[model samples]
Target: MGKHLESDGPSSFSRDTVKAIISQFLGFLLDAYDLTMILTIAPVLAVVLFPPSSSLLATFNVIFAYSLTIIFRPLGSAIFGHLGDKLGRRTDLIITVLGLGITSALTAALPTYAQVGILSYILFVIIRIGVGIFAGGEYAAGHPFAMEWTPYKWRGFISGLVQGGFSFGSMLTAAVLSLFISTFGVKGLETYAWRYLFLTTLIPAVIALAIRLSMKETPIFSDLKAQNKIRKSPFLDLFRKPYRRDFFQVMLFMTGLFFYSYSLFAFVPTILEHKPSVFSLSTANHIYTIGTVAAFFGAVLFGTLTQIVGRRRLALIWAVITFIVSIPMYYMLMYGASIGNVAIATIAVIIIGIIAQGPWGMIPIYLSERFKASMRSSGLGFGYSSGIFLGGWFSIYVPLMHEYLFKSIDTPTNVWFSTAVLLMIGAVIVGIGQYLGPETLGTRLSE
Candidate 1:
């Protein structure tokens, strides 16, 4: 802690730190926009690509594609994580941005099942896998790059800026989808509007790549590499010494975070699907748009809060609030609520955004501080990527569980009650986890 305090002295800020934060923020923005665009468009795409009777199947197909991506994310993270550590963060960042952009563009050109038969599905799966792999690399590099560049005193705020980009991207996606759908008839959207959605990824992807290209490797990683202090087996070494307990704690914390995140995100759209009266496609999308906007501000607010109060304290407070609010907020949305009611529900969603989503702002720093620079990339990559795997896949199963096993969607009340119960459980887990976690504010990168 004394070393951490020393590192927090006046010399911490630099022009390069600003560049790194902006570059990583842009990359996250693009990733978020692309991912959310796909999620928002899935329902509409189902109506377009599949037979009318197979709409549900189409929804499942999209989910399956997403599941494939989630499953492969860790592999991408591990592969690129090593590259980021051994080669350079800048190198990996550039490659991932270009790869993700190219894959997204290719997705725009893919034919429908009607046109290509089974080949369309195959192509979709392959494209998603490619995107998933690149996305895996993006986070592995992006977070560390931002953390390594910034001083400890402002790490939470800078990291929040990076995380905030995701919310902005989501907001941008919702706006894009809304505009496209409004302008193009649903039939027209099915034919060509979706293609434009894919094309939009190209702009941010190119920008992120360019920004990253101009940036150098983190001073921290560079210094470590210069000393030949790189770990021979970073994954193995992550648990070998002082890092073992911290590693496990971060892993558990991340797992709870992702579980609640995935569950909330997956369930929201599905629940919207079930409640046409309250959430027509347009209306539901509007809710998502508003929620994303809320998330953007929430991230900024929480990030700033972390700086003032410390990361661990902020996380614990927000997590408890999220847990208490989960059930009631969701129940309100489940019944035939008005748009205004849904808007109110956004308050809870915003809090979730702040707590579950906001802690990620500090994660890059938290993980980096937990390990030496030699193993930082591998530790952060493995921990965060593994959390995504567990949380991401389990979320897919939640919809399936509710739809097939519980038969909860049979009635409005059942749907509300079931989702509320699931959220309650997730909220409790996340809240407790945060309380027991370490506070890494002002931690030294070189420690």
Candidate 2:
């Protein structure tokens, strides 16, 4: 630890470091915006894809559309993780950004259910799967690239800021699309508004590309190449000795992260719009925007704090808080809505946002510090993404848990009971997983 320790010296704030951070932050912002835009857009798309009478199926179909993207992410992680480890993070990241932007832009040209029946829905599903793949690839390359460039002393802060881009992206998407839908109303949403909204997805791609073109490979990756330490068949190497154990442990931590994150994000809109009366899409979206703004701040705050408390310890604390508050905060949200009180709901969202999202800020550094520099990208990419196997199923699990809890769906309850249960499960997994793992705070990356 003493020999490998890094100093907060001049090289810590080098030009390439700044570029790496900027590229990842902006690139992930694009990832979250495009991927999550489908959630707001899905409602409008349901109109074009399903018959007027298909309500239950319409909602299920919409949820599944996004789920397909989430589930397919591992394949992309595997493919791109290998590329990042072998060819280099810079090249892998460049390819993935272009792919994500192109795939996102293609959604605007897709035909509707009325225009081509089920064929239209199939086409949309194909595009979303493409999105899932590239998103996974971006995750593989982006974090390692940035973290390797970061100084050890500020690793936690940089991790938080980079991962916080996801929160910022989510908030931005809600603000922009929510306002767009509010301006047009439901009918206009079903008309030209939806397509135009999707067309705007190209902007992030262009922005990220300009930034990446100017950036160089990290100092660490360059060192590895000079020594010829880059692993052949990097993805397969994960299953070999030394790396495999840490790889799977980080996978569990990531699973817990995704579970709580999806629970917080996927269903809140339904609660805001349908359950609580006197709330419409316009007002509900404001709540979403405000809540995510809180999340971005929460992430940065926790990231900074991890520099003090240590990553494993903070994760234990946050997971416990998330479990404890899960049911009560949601109850408050429902009660606030039932009584036509927006203030209580807003408070619930803010508290929940902070406690729920803080671990995400810590994880970027935690995972990056866990693996050796030689296998860092592959280990981080696949280990982090493999969690989706079990964790990403919340869209399906929510309904299943709702039925298990109530024996039927309850309008007032939504999936609150299930979400609470899900949070608890996530709490236990992350709490124990991270606790049993190494505490990587302030640890320097080593080849």
Q: Estimate the TM-score of every prediction.
A: 0.90, 0.95
Which portions of model 1 show Cα errors greater than 4 Å? 3-12, 54-57, 239-244, 336-352, 404-417
Candidate that would win on lDDT: 2
Shift of residue 231 alpha carbon in model 1, Å:
1.9
Best by TM-score: 2
Query: Can you tell me which runs of candidate 2 are displaced by over 4 Å?
Result: 7-10, 54-57, 407-413
Writing each residue's lDDT as its tens digit, candidate 2 over 190-273 gives 876778777787887888888888888887888889999988878888888877888788888888888878766776665665
- C-alpha lDDT values of all predictions: 0.70, 0.80
Residues 1-447 of candidate 1: C-alpha lDDT, one tens digit per residue: 642453532247677777788877777788788778767777766765566655545675676677668777777878888778878788988898898789877888988877876677778778888988888888787788888877666776776777788888888988888888789966678887788878988998888777777788887778878888877777677677777776777667777777665544555655666543365677777776776777777777677777778877877776677667766666566543444466565555555455446556666666666666677777777777776655667545555566776664435222444555555565666666667766767667762
- For each of the candidates, the C-alpha root-mean-square deviation to the true structure, in angstroms, is 2.7, 1.9
Q: Please report, as a residue range, the 10-residue window in candidate 1 with the lowest summed lDDT.
A: 408-417
